[model samples]
Target: MMRLRFLRPPGARPEKEFLARCLQCGQCAQVCIFDCIKMRTGFNPFTSGTPEISPRDAPCHLCMRCSAICPSDALEDVSIEESKMGYAKLDRKLCHTWKGFIICRSCYERCPLKATAMVLEKGIYPAITDRCVGCGVCEHVCPEQAIVTIPTRFVT
Candidate 1:
């Protein structure tokens, strides 16, 4: 998958270049405060060691846990914003609740971008809409590891 770079302000360096040096060992993923980062199998193998952020799947709250522990430059100094960061996408098929199993919607409850970001459907298994902000709360708290914050360009 091609690495995606958002528009940076003046004098800002390419985030991909920083991510290029990442080892993708998942060390940063473990230390992240908001659980915004995730590992991907396919994509830029060149920077495979780094974790990626998606606002809908896992939004970066700027807690800086991942960047704090990054051994490489993968998560170098960079500012995070709701609009700039692509959010998480949910796979209902992989979700425990969608599978007719009892599961908590912590992500839905913890979302900072409620209403517009996450809309709940009334059904036996409620569906979360694409409006989700991709906060890592669900992925972070999930015991099943069903959700992940995939790269925006690489998700398909």
Candidate 2:
């Protein structure tokens, strides 16, 4: 499986404070310019109104649409820098590189952060760098599902 790196906001206080206040009414989701805001299934058993988005499915663009539309401050106001999801990891075992396939570069080629995040290594099959942003675009774009982004907290 591809390694994922989760980047919680600095000083994140269960930052669920914002999350807990949400009504999950879909207003914020509707206002998302990038469609990154989504409600999680069974995110809360007692309270079903909380909305959560998977940064892996669609990383927040920091457009602030969701935060602005949130009536209850369920989505806190954060700067793009404060809200980054962080680096992504590519599993050599599941990647086409390890499989000896030549069908995909979607991960390497599609990375929005470029050289800083997905640098290339020299080899017959090649490899990705350590600076990945865990955007999951590589995982989603991969036809093999060889890539997965895990929370950075789990690493090290």
Compared with the true structure, all predictions reach lDDT values of 0.51, 0.54
Query: Which candidate leads in TM-score?
Result: 2
Count backbone overlaps in model 2: 12
Instruction: Please give the distance, in angstroms, between residue 48's alpha carbon in candidate 2 and its true position after superposition.
Output: 2.2
lDDT of 1 by residue, 88-153 (tens): 556777777777677567666665565556656663443445654344555555555666654332
lDDT of 2: 0.54
Q: Once superposed on the true structure, which residue ranges of model 1 sit more than 4 Å away at CA?
A: 1-59, 62-81, 123-126, 153-156
Off by over 4 Å in 2: 1-15, 21-25, 34-36, 42-47, 54-64, 68-82, 123-131, 151-156
Candidate 2: residue 63 Cα off by (Å): 4.9
Q: Pick the candidate with the highest lDDT.
A: 2
RMSD per candidate (Å) reads 7.9, 5.6
Error of model 2, residue 38, in angstroms: 2.2
